[model samples]
Target: MKNVIITGTSRGIGFEMVKLFSEAGHNVLALSRNSKPVSDLKLKNVTALEFDIANEPEVVNLSAYLQKAMKTVDVLINNAGFLVNKPFAEITAEEFKRSYGVNVFGVASLIKTALPFMKTDGHVVNISSMGGIQGSVKFPGLSAYSSSKGAVITLTELLAEEYKETGPSFNVLALGSVQTEMLEEAFPGFKAPLSATEMAEYILDFSLSGNKFYNGKILQVSSTTP
Candidate 1:
């Protein structure tokens, strides 16, 4: 069984992933700001951690846990995201900072902390959004959120190149609209074609095998735009 670390595991896709990976007999470290949901499940081989990527102390705590509990890292899925839907003109500097803090900087921090424990066959999957793709459907209120995701795409490519001689392949996924609580919060009354479990299954499969075929690539996993 592989040792997998998945962020944003409180609900939605991340929550579903915890189940899928656990059922597949993988050791999963599920991290989220509120990890009670997964903690409540009390699944075998799954550790629910109350984590906030934007918090430095929490990142350090995660590093300690990884070093102490999990000797090696097999799969690290940066599924945590932060979105602020506000008009561009009305967007505040702090809002953009917070978005970037979680969506971009937080991801980089985790990778740095986890890289030491990752081997050549390890995989790092960073999750982005379809709206982050340039020239895709642009939404007015997501300037901060989408742009931050775009940054993650570029970051993934750079890391892959830097680690070419090393190990741990990195890839990013620009997902299309998935019917998640985040989507519901962003756009109420809008129904997405794919459910959380459906997307989770796809992601679980990819996180395990996608690295063999592609690295430093961005896969668009959405059939519809939100």
Candidate 2:
């Protein structure tokens, strides 16, 4: 029904999103550092692309590929992220850079490249964390990850305003901990209240129909109120 591009589709939320959108009959361009997972899906409407989001050359290649494959994009979901949990003192500079490289720069690059192919009134959803929301629950050892998500929220707001007179709408979804591999890694032994599939379903519906009512807003998706 629509042309959708989702980044970080190797697994977890991104993977579920690829299944959700493609099964709904949308043309889905799924990006991941490794294409094997999506490749195995064998979905008729899904195209798997292999590339690291943190790499500029790969992103450029994605842009060029999209230019040739799609005339217009209805949705762009920036779902790729890097997380490193450690005490603030133990957080290395390299770690921070790595986190920002994927969480921040990767997101910016995709938006920059995808906008040209986006149809008027298209939706751009940047996946963020609840920790990124001001006054939200704080956790130790999430310095880099939280900070990067915060930056994503800011960028979404600014981009939305910058493109107000134009076409596409930009929004950030600051989600609570979801039950996924990323959550397991970030908080070992702890169980998250929401599942990735649930989140993906909501995101698919919002991107396809509900996004027009909102622009430049950061909605915190969580069972527990922040």
Candidate 3:
């Protein structure tokens, strides 16, 4: 019934969000570098758009396209990310920039363009990693990824405060490892405790309810049992 926009919809958690939201009867604007996954879904409620999230031009184009098609966006999930698991000493400046380009700058650009179309009481959920949290799970070589996510958390907090009078709420979710391509690439040989579908389900609930009372929160999501 509501309009939702999701980034990184080509696979993993973003893909699952597309499926979940579409099935829940929401109009979903699914953005990804590769549009095949969402195109293949052939859902009536889902519209797939292919674009480079890290590219400002592409993000701007997407925003214009959506503005023409949708009157208001009820939820915006900034889930697209890039991960580089290299030793801090080995990580080049270029590598760090690439990671931030996608994980941070891309997210900010999308938000800037989409804010105009966001509905009142809308929710903006920035997907971050648990590694970004001060005392959450830490990996050996995820410095770039963790730091980018940490920045996202800070950005979310500042936006929430800056837009307190505005109807839309901003919050960040620090997620534990989930079974996804990004996870496998970041932590080779390690098994994740949660599935993308599980995480998407939990996120869907929060996207609808979390804004009621909470904003600017860094929510750490993980399994209830070990």
Top-lDDT candidate index: 1
RMSD to the native, candidate 1? 0.9
Better candidate by TM-score, 1 or 3: 1
Off by over 4 Å in 3: 224-226
TM-score of 1: 0.98
Q: Give a tens-digit lDDT track for model 2, residues 1-226.
A: 8999999899999999999887888999999988999999799889998879899988888877887898789899999999999999999999999999999999999899999988668999999999898889888899999999999999999999999888699988998888899889887898877889999998888877756689999988888732
Candidate 2 ranges with C-alpha deviation above 4 Å: none
Q: Candidate 3's residue-wise lDDT over 25-58, tens digit each?
A: 9999999999998999898799998878899899
Cα-based lDDT at residue 225, candidate 3: 18
Mark the regions of model 1 whose C-alpha exceeds 4 Å error after superposition. Answer: none
Residue 135, candidate 1: how far off, in angstroms?
1.8
- TM per candidate comes to 0.98, 0.97, 0.95
The best-first sequence of candidates by lDDT reads 1, 2, 3
Clashing pairs in 2: none
User: lDDT of each structure?
Assistant: 0.94, 0.90, 0.88
Among residues 3 or more apart in sequence or in different chains, the pairs in candidate 3 whose N, CA or C atoms overlap within 3 Å are none
After aligning candidate 3 to the native by TM-score, how far in Å is the CA of 16 from where it should be?
A: 0.9
- Angstrom error of the Cα, residue 150, model 1: value is 0.1
Q: Of the pair 1 and 2, which is ahead by lDDT?
A: 1
lDDT of 1 by residue, 125-196 (tens): 999999888889998899999999999999999999999778799999999989899989988898999999
